[model samples]
Target: MNEEELGTDLKKRIKEVLSGSLHIRHVDTGSCNGCDFEMSTLSNPIYDISRFGVSFVPSPRQADMLMVTGGVTSNLEKALRITYEATPKPKMVLAIGACACGGGVFGETYANAGGIDPFVPVYVYVPGCPPRPQALIQGILLALDQYEEVLKRGE
Candidate 1:
């Protein structure tokens, strides 16, 4: 299916799976802002993920998913943990960008914690120096699929 078809299908799936909406909280650990910018693009008219019942929320307490970007920095490790704990149960965590997946070029530095996996359970990983908006959407869809499975297992 083309992107339009996919968007329509994704909208339906999100509604059925997430009880109408999926609110995301974005966390930036320590990379450049490229991935963050790409994620923000989903709210633009062209992508308009809001129509799919997907929105970026300001607080983890209000989020259904955590779209984490950048490598885990020492300064942000505690914050990440707190954010994860603050989110309600059955939440999905998506590690976006290469930096979040494996720390990118700044891998395991004195100030960087390598990847988010060491800190929290990641449900999806979208790898790239900075993945495009399309990839980010794909990652979200993947996370939704996993969420569906988790629900089915009553987890």
Candidate 2:
């Protein structure tokens, strides 16, 4: 499919996964805050993701999706696990940025504990040192595709 078609398909899948409920909780393990900055901008006037029926939640327990950024750090492992554990069933994790997906610049650093996938299964990975907001959105939409099928099977 063409890029536009693919994007449209992704959006459709996202809508299906959401099914009128798409609350996300963001976690920062040890990011440089660049990803966080773009994520925050997603809610602003320019590209309000709320228009697509998505919202950012403060508590993990109340979220249907976990949007994690940054490389997994030794100090934040416990917190990350707790956050994931707190999230209710049928939740998907989206690792945004190269750091979160592959440890990026900190891959072999003393403080690095690897990527998010090692600790918790990542449904999607947006690969960029600091992924653009559009890239993050696309990753979320891709995860939604698999998430919808999983939910349908009641897994």
Best by lDDT: 1
Q: Candidate 1, residues 1-155: lDDT per residue as tens digits? A: 24757787778889889879889999888779999999999999988999988888888989999999899988989989999999999999999999999989888889998899999999999998789888887888888899999999998
lDDT for every model? Answer: 0.89, 0.83
Question: With candidate 1 superimposed using the best TM-score fit, by how many Å does residue 7's alpha carbon deviate from the native?
Answer: 1.1
- Model 2 global lDDT (CA atoms, 0 to 1): 0.83
- The TM-score that candidate 1 achieves is 0.94
Per-candidate TM equals: 0.94, 0.90
- Model 2 worst lDDT window (10 residues): 1-10
Tens-digit per-residue lDDT, 1-155, candidate 2: 23555445545666666656589999999899989999998889987777777789989999999999998888998999999999999989999888998888888577897688879998988888677777877787778778878878988
